[model samples]
Target: MTVRILVVDDSPFMRKSLQKMLEEAPDLKVVATARDGIDALEKLEEHKPDLVTLDIEMPRMDGLTCLRKIMATHPLPVLMVSSLTQEGAQATLDALSLGALDFIPKESSFATMSIMQIQQDLQEKVRRLAASPRFHPRPPAEPPAVRPARPAVPSVPISAVPIPAGTALPASPTAELLVIGSSTGGPKALQDILPALPADLPVPCLIVQHMPSTFTRPFADRLDGLCQVHVKEAEQGEPLKAGTVYIAPGGIHMLYGARGPKGCVELTPEPVSSLHRPSVDVLFQSVADHYRGQVLATILTGMGADGAKGMEQLKRKGAHTLAESEESCVVYGMPRAAVERGCVDLVAPLPDIAGHLRRHFRL
Candidate 1:
């Protein structure tokens, strides 16, 4: 089935470029184009497209306002077109928080007529968003007024079914470090999971979320304010500490390593051949090398098989591994890949993941 798309951007060149790129794929069709948010709304009502490619910085009604309107009135899959600037990064993060399915970075001035990267990213994201049955706007989240105290986790009876969908068996206490990987619908998923973890978590957490370099810091900051555990973007050479969540910055790989007396995060661009800069395989394999059976690794929602190989390595080393259940995943790709590889120890839905972690870590 051909996926109908509405392209919204103030730049005529960008709109044309996007339309051209998308139409190149036989499955994708640009049904209409809108210059700004107001026009985009009208186009949305008129075209009722399967997906929308929205630009964040537009005159008249901004993309965020338009996205808010879309989610409020008629929630659908919306992919944001964002610039690589810091301001653009902030707005894109806001858009994701507002329920955009994903985003593709745009260059300033739309100078390049033929952008291979943007074209490839646009086509893939649009098609996936259109075809995904799980694609739905995330419910709007009100930013917490203040950093919240750790919410209490109520105890439940241990179930005979050891790996039930919602319940978790007590996890082994030997696991010392926690590493998580996600993509596609990860921002909202992370928001759901991270804040629920107690502030006094016994082990440090490392997260690899596929995102642009400019956006990671802001994303981490947003999570920091909302979560009980201290969350921040990982800095090179910083010691990995318990009760802290380190988010890998975009455009680079983050790995586990020791700095003489303390274990620290090592950011590198080597093996630049990897598909994703902050590749899950890179991080997971590193943990497998250092901690082996002492690690707890998870593959959350994402678009590709990046983490599956790493999960296999971890599993061989006796690490406890979890995959987000399909019913709870936005894309179900990464976790599905890991599960198919026979590496996942638990398959849990999004709401239950943090609880499982709490149980495993004895938080």
Candidate 2:
């Protein structure tokens, strides 16, 4: 089937370029091109394309604002075209939270990149998104009847297993950091886990969620408001602290490392590895290298084997590992891969993960 696309950008050259590129694919078509968000909205009524490729920077209405409106009114899948700068990264992430499906970097030389290479990437993204199910805007479901909030409970530290002679384990449980890897249904899964955590939880949580840049901060902000713990986008050399969650920003990798007197989170602008920025593998590998038995690795719902290898590293290093079970996942790919590799120490449903975490920490 032909995948219909609406191309939205302020640059006439960009719009034309995208149109030409997409038209060359037998299974894809640029049904419409809009110079900006207003024009895109107008074209939406006329063409009803199956997907949209949006530019982050635009006059009158920016991509994010347009994305929010699109998600609210139309809810078609959108892939953002963003620059590599920090501002662009932030905006791209915001777009993701606003419900854009994914993004491609709009480098200054993107136009001159091998047309064949660009075409291949564009086709893959468009086909994947088009084939994926779309999220429709719906009224909020009524909340379940309120019950008494669970009382705060102190977490008991799990007895640390000794690392191998060559490996390292932190001297205290407080020195350990939790590294979480997730994708697909991660945002909702994180909401379920974080908000239920007590204010005094004893370890910092570092999360690698498969998402574009601007969206992670908003996702973190949403978590911060609802959860007892503080949530923020991870920064370079940021010290991990108890009762806090750090989400890796999109378009960059977040690695675990020793900073000064202790281990902390580090951000790297490394080229995409394993087809993802903020790769689960990079985070897991780093944790294994630095924290060894002090790490707790959990692989959640996602579409690939991105975390499986890293989970194996963590398991070999004697860190406890968990996987979200099949019944609870939007896609069973990542967790399933980890489980099959014998890397998962336990498999639990989404609702049960928090309880297991509480039990593990003895909270």
Q: How many residue pairs clash in all the candidates, one count each? A: 0, 9
Point out where model 1 deviates above 4 Å: 136-170, 260-262
Predicted candidate 2 versus true structure: per-residue lDDT over 1-363, tens digit per residue: 999999999999889888888888898999899988999999999999999999988999989889988988888889889886767766765676677766777877876786666676777777766655344323567989989999889999886532223112222343256789998767767878988889888888889998667567767877898899899999888787888889999889999877754468789877554588989999888888877447778888777788899989988977777788766665567888887787776777788888877766766
Best by lDDT: 1
Best by TM-score: 1
Per-candidate Cα lDDT values, in order, are 0.87, 0.79
Q: Cα deviation of 12 in candidate 1 (Å)?
A: 1.2
What overall lDDT, based on C-alpha atoms, would model 2 receive against the true structure? 0.79
| Model 2 worst lDDT run, 10 consecutive residues | 162-171
Q: How far off is residue 217 in model 2, in Å?
A: 8.3
